[model samples]
Target: MTASRPAVEIFANPRADRSAPRPGVLTHEARAEAQAAIRAWPGYAPTPLLDLPGLARRLGVAAVRWKDEGGRFGLGSFKALGGAYAVQRLVREHGGDVTFAAATDGNHGRSVAWGAKQAGARAVIYLHAGVSPGREAALRALGAEIVRVAGNYDDSVRQCARAAAERGWQVVSDTAWEGYREVPTAVMAGYSLIAAEAVAQMGAERPTHVLVQGGVGGVAAAICAELREAWGADAPRFVVVEPALAACLLESARRGGRTEIPIAEETVMAGLSCGDPSPLAWEILDTGADDFAAVDDAWVPPAMRLLADGESGDPRVVAGESGVAGLALLLAARERSETWAALGLDAGSRVLLIGTEGATDPEIYREIVGRGADEVAGTVAR
Candidate 1:
């Protein structure tokens, strides 16, 4: 018999105050500025918003729309939007000879490196012990000088900040802390583009629920801000999902403030294995987000397979380990009637999910899905 999937941990944020003012970082002006600049870049294009009628039927929902970011800017992840856009802003403000630095599990580093290359600048990426070698190799291929840190993602963030400050290099981090908010603010603005495109692709058909994966909570908060801005009181109910092993966002929601958890073990969902929550992201998510959920690693592989298999005539999607967290949480939650009811999920509900990354690491993708990304995408014959 197969090992049973763990119970999903759900938290209805008690402090969610929708009447509060919008976070300053996510203003309309900032988002528009970032969008215009990013669009002007040579390879900018909107990723597809796929209709998943199969999953909708399985979950008894009216519809399920998936924003597939696997092929975003040919970088294989949605992260191509944020870090690269931030790098462009920095390069324009500063000079072309500057060095940009950041901490990453993989995708963000690649974006920063690619941006640096485009601007004729330098990139220095910091990685923790838990990050995969394939991710490191991908960054190196983009011309980033890799620095291995001792602890988890948060630790790597600290080291990256310190080294960048000491060496006079710019830190283009997605998370924000005291006295450090501008670059991260711009990063979040760039991320809002994903939500903007999704809303446009959706047209007049509005979704009732949005289930988004959270790492440091940057992307989740960005999407929430964007949708809420676009639709106001008519926006979808936002749900943030993270790995159970490193569910700092959930813990923060429970405590009614920013919180950090000790990462004793790393989840296979590498990008979501972040122990600390971003303060900038939390400001928006604290009020904008309706729910937070933690899903176990056991659900990841199956979610990836389900997308790859395209059950019930759904289109095949190349979702990576981290990319499937939102879907994994949905699958786990629907198994429990109480949890399902509490989330307000019903047959009439229209839900949206974000597939944040593709096969960022091909070896791991093959091991989990039993096929290459191209094969799952029908680009190669099986």
Candidate 2:
């Protein structure tokens, strides 16, 4: 099946000022602490930074590198780092039989549940009606008590907050509200580990641009902070990508603050279908991110299939619908010369894209990519 090129809306951040103090909540010291703590966990190792030469050639770029987080802690997403680290830190600071509660489209909740279990605490996860049954089952497998909300992702978040307050459960959320910022801050800090690994893996070869998929923007903020610290004034151009249907970050950038969009429909990129920009994440991305781009959901499946059918000796990648947003946006933008130039993309540009997950929902993944992750991996092995 041939997928049509996605339509994109690009907004350059007018508030992008990288002046005196950095715009991020996470400091280098806090990131270091989170990294050390996470490294102590069992099965903690750096995920791969794959060089996609064929893609680079096809896209008329110098290089296209993918930071694959599919196998991160075996959770199938990079989110495994954040919530788990925050839970560990929470347990260390405030002892006792605590319970963690939060809302998720899928991946973050699973990570939080796994973290709570590892920390000898309990977890309750709230999912919106759109969350797939497979995702709920995954959360249940991680020992989280599940509550299904009738509304969208934002509604689920509100429900989780109320339940946590009433039940005395600490919220280990990735998004931050007015008075509830600490845990989410810690979660963002933990995500800096990805940037650190990617930088080290690249060695002396720095990327010219980075396209990060955004939900509430925690991961993008974390990456921005790390890159800013490492490259100072010369950090690579950062673009936050989202599903057009649920582009809170893009809308927030256009509005010049933390803006919430009322969700009218669900996007195929379930994980990126967040209606609100995380206040904590927005603090950083407002200034640190150069541009915000939104893509049609139709682009996702084709992006996933492209990764699964690796080219020019590049190993197959098992990116989920949400995970392929960065690549989809890149492809969409490249089709328009003006958009490509606006993003500073050229033949010499070295681009970095994050493959945020494997087949987290195997059923949906197979439907999109035409094969299971394991099957693709087996082919790669041969």
Candidate 3:
């Protein structure tokens, strides 16, 4: 199943029209259906979009809106949306009593494992060789069997794929390739509910811009498609951010096609690491994206520092490397003052960003960002 893989283009210093309109993404019916399905979770918690005024002032932006997915199901990441949707749909489609199984990079696997328990099923997750022991332990605590792969995330995904094929276990994955588009597509659709909620919460004061992190592009695809569809041509400008070392989406934009890379992607932002762009999401983001930016590991520590210092003057938020790195992008854009001008990001501009996860590996988070925010805060309060 070897195929043509293109080198990805990283969009930045964008030369294209910022306001160029794209086609509609999800339909009203599709959105409503997805919303209803999420509501059925019963235990679904309302993740908030905090208005980061202090952070916004620091970034020189009119406003910064954050969709904090920390402590989401006590899992500390946003992958719960995809994992949950994939499990429920898989069980219903194939007929099951509520069990799910998959390999993960910690967050996704745990999300699936947690969702399976909620859906009345069990999950076994596999991981790549280098996954931190802390993450493996966390996944196991969710009651998943953690299998180690020989290589990277995609490699573990392949192992999961083979296992699912042979054992008839459902693989709750976000990335899609040949002959396996439906469930992943559903996962993307499910994630779209996040942006939908953001928009709904904003109401008449919808965000004028969006900055989404890219892994395999499921969350980005969902947001881009939904923004275009729900808001039409006049919607907010869209931008994507990724780790400089693990920017597979940016590589795809360069090659003018979906590109595969060396996968030597060692970075603090493990959540945003992917060697290939999901084909389905690539198709949607090809021309729909406005810009792409890469943040170095250098900026993550500072951003993480800031995420912990919220409006409450306490370290209220905990995030993974990629999660906090998004703040780096927002701050840079605000500093450059060019993207802001180009996108008409004035005082009125309401911009949105995602805190995709909270410390997928607390030990790793402590290592990267200096003593975990949660720990330092607890110590301070005591």
Candidate 4:
């Protein structure tokens, strides 16, 4: 398929307050605490940081590194850290009997359900109409009671909130709204575990750029906060990439505040098809993110295929639609000389892209990459 070129928006975050007394949403202490807690969890291990020398040569960059979260806890997404950790915290603070609820396109709901089960709590997940059956089935497999809503992802989030309020269930959401900051704060802090691992793995070598996928901006904010804490004034330039159809972060950055985009159609990037920016996330990303770029859905599949097939000698990676967004944006940017220069990307640039998921939806994965995730993983293993 001939993918439409991505539209790039380069912005310097003027409001980015990298100052101390960091936003209460996520702090260095919270990140360290989360890292310790997650390390103690069963099967908790740092995901691989893959060096794609061949891909770097092909893209004409000094180096390209991929943080592979596809195998994170075997849940197939980095969200396993966020929702599960938040649910565990809530269960420990409140009680194991507390019911948890959240809205998700896919991964977060599964994490919530898994966390609830592990914590001996009940979970109900709300899904928008656009979520595929495979995704819903995955949540059901985790024992979450599913509620299908008629609207988009934001609508489902609202439904989840309403149901949580009426039924007295605790909402373990990744997105934040007014009077709903703490849980999402915890979620974003949990995500800082990823940044911590990447930083440690990079050792003395730091990338010049870090491309993060933008949803409600939780992951991007968490990564930016953690990187700033680690690298201080020398942190890599952080870029946020999202689907063009649901570019809430881009819209919010353009407007200079938290803003919502009305979703007219669903983008293939189910995980990133968010209409609203999380207020808690915006608190950090407003100044933390360096640039925001929106890509067409068509760019996603080729990225998934490229990772699965392994460019040059890079090992095959199983990144899903949402997981491949950063790489997709990077690939798209390389085609435009002006966009590449604006980001300061060139032969001497070292870049890091987070593959936030594997084939969370196996059917869609097979269709896009022309092979199942298991097949690619097994091939890579050999």
Candidate 5:
């Protein structure tokens, strides 16, 4: 795995707050193209913006909402939004009638495989051994070849990048470096579609803040960047949340310079347990994020259960660990009322947290939620 590239090189302009434009980031035209490509994606769902009235009651906020990405496009996560669009853009520009490849802890690879299938291409997905069998099976069921690597997500990314270089396969990765910005940019752009849809879904009442789950930081950057545009001078407060084991952005932010956190990433939220941020994502986030937070593995599960168990007799939300971990930030935010007080959140403030994934890794989810896979599933469905 590569060390974190300097944020200045990637983003160039860093601002104290996200409201001002950064220098040399994605151009408006490029963003528009990405928006168009994401809309063109087959099986794309403008996912629901769910109201969590009970959770709002708990947080003492006016409202709480979830952007549900579970079971989106048959993959159990939101990473597909970026992965699939990246694959389509790469295949269209670079080559066609060929194969697409990616390395992911779970979601991104599944997305690439799914998109390649739709685009009439083949795919090879590299996964670390930590990935649950359920996720592996899901990829294989989509007709994509799954290769088990022996290390963490960062290791798998390196392995996949090398193999793609040698085997003449196109890689649609969310992480990027000097010469690798093309696909990562497309990936980030594709991911912006989420916030695009989300901003529209909000209508007149915009969210006061967003709690976006960070893996390689692609989706977080995408969502934050679009919010920058949608909200313009008054963009919502952007917070990047991650597993404690892999707070590359948080650690980097602390160092006042870029830092590569070596992650023996041990979390049930495998999707966010990534070591390095995409260079592009790092760039956007370093300048755009108002603050960063990390939560322990213990916080991930109960939150999953809380969502999957439903609130106030509603059907269960079926949020797996990776998805629901985003809301753990809400819990912490409420716990430290002072943290949000300065951000101006009160009962009238609308908060958006992503339910980013479904049951992509059921074993991990069950272990986190302290229930068998089937035990509480019907509750979510009912």
Candidate 6:
């Protein structure tokens, strides 16, 4: 029997201080530097911004724009903009043969490995027990040595930190802690490119609401910071989404501070199964995000299928499990009139959802969507 869906937990941030200054780490100058650097690299085309008229009609919204990052730098995830860029920055600062290490459930590791390969450096990636073999293999194919850890993502992160420090390997983590700010700040700066690209693609037409998935809240914070800087008082309402099973950001928002939760169970959204909120990311998200929504894992498969099937005549998108979190949150929220009204979503609302990754794990994608990513992209016969 199919399992039942859980109630969607929504929390409105009481601390969305619009007058607060933007975080120093992700300032416009930092993004400019990152943009110029990243654009100079090979294969740096901006991902497509797709208009989903049919989806908008169905959802009672004026427009729905999807910033599809599946093809980002040919890495199949928006993480391509962050981890790799941070690695490159480190290589420039250190040396060509400098070693970098990171703990990841998937995409970020691939990005670091890819960056290391480009610079002829060494990459050591750590994965928790829950990460799929397909994801581990992807990192290995990118030329990273994989180390399996004992517990959850947070455990792997601790192990990675210890090992990196002992082995003299620079930790190129996407999540920032107390003392480890510079590298993660650089990572988030690179992620600011997503908002930059989206702003350019939209061309003065700004969304009323932007729903972004939160994994340690890095990408969401980056986007929130960038859009707030770009639009100032006219910034779009930011909604941070995550799996209910691992809603560290939401809990942090509710508590009015950075919070960490224990991961008792792993969600199918492997990329978002993080238990700890990044301290640096929290600095921006505390006041930048308007709301935090955690939706059940049961909503993911259907959302993925919806994007793949293009049920509304929209172009097909190969959004992975974690990639579809924002869409899942939207689907859940619309079903409840209270949530829909609370979010100020209506006939005139222009919604922006980022498809954060493609088929990062083809096996899981095929199992969930019943088709391969290439087939959905029309590259292979369906």
Any runs in candidate 6 off by more than 4 Å, and if so which? Answer: 1-5, 380-382
User: What TM-score does prediction 2 earn?
Assistant: 0.96
116-193, model 6: which lDDT tens digit per residue?
999999999999999999999999998999999999999999999999989899999999876899999899999999
Shift of residue 86 alpha carbon in model 1, Å: 0.7
Rank by TM-score, highest first.
6, 1, 2, 4, 5, 3
Tally clashing residue pairs in candidate 2: 0
Better of 2 and 5 by TM-score: 2
Q: Lowest lDDT 10-mer window, candidate 3?
A: 1-10
TM-score of each: 0.97, 0.96, 0.87, 0.96, 0.89, 0.97
Instruction: Please give, for residues 20-118, the per-residue lDDT of candidate 3 as tens digits.
Output: 443234445655666679867766767887777776666556778888877566677888788877787777777665345566667788778877776
User: Can you write out model 2's per-residue Cα lDDT over 63-119, one digit (the tens) per residue?
Assistant: 999999988988889999999888888888877489889899999998999998888
Clashing pairs in 2: none
> What do the candidate models score in CA lDDT, each in turn?
0.90, 0.88, 0.73, 0.88, 0.75, 0.90
lDDT of 5 by residue, 143-254 (tens): 8998899988888999998998999889888899778898888777777777888888989888887888878788888888788876775887777787766777777777
Model 6 lowest lDDT segment of ten = 1-10
- Candidate 4: residue pairs that collide: 16-287
Q: Point out where model 4 deviates above 4 Å.
A: 1-8, 12-24, 379-382
Q: Please write out the lDDT profile of model 1 over residues 1-382, one tens digit for every residue.
A: 1245355888998877677667557889999999899888886788899999998898788999999998888888988899999999998899898999999999989999999999989999999999999889989998999999999999999999999889999999999989899999988999999999999999999999999998899999899888888888778888999988889999998888889999998999999989999999998998778899999888899899999989799999889999999889888888899889888999899999998998999889999999998899965211
Error of 1 at 6 (Å): 4.7
**C-alpha positional error of residue 180 in candidate 4 after TM-score superposition, expressed in Å:** 1.3
In model 4, the worst 10-residue window by lDDT is: 1-10
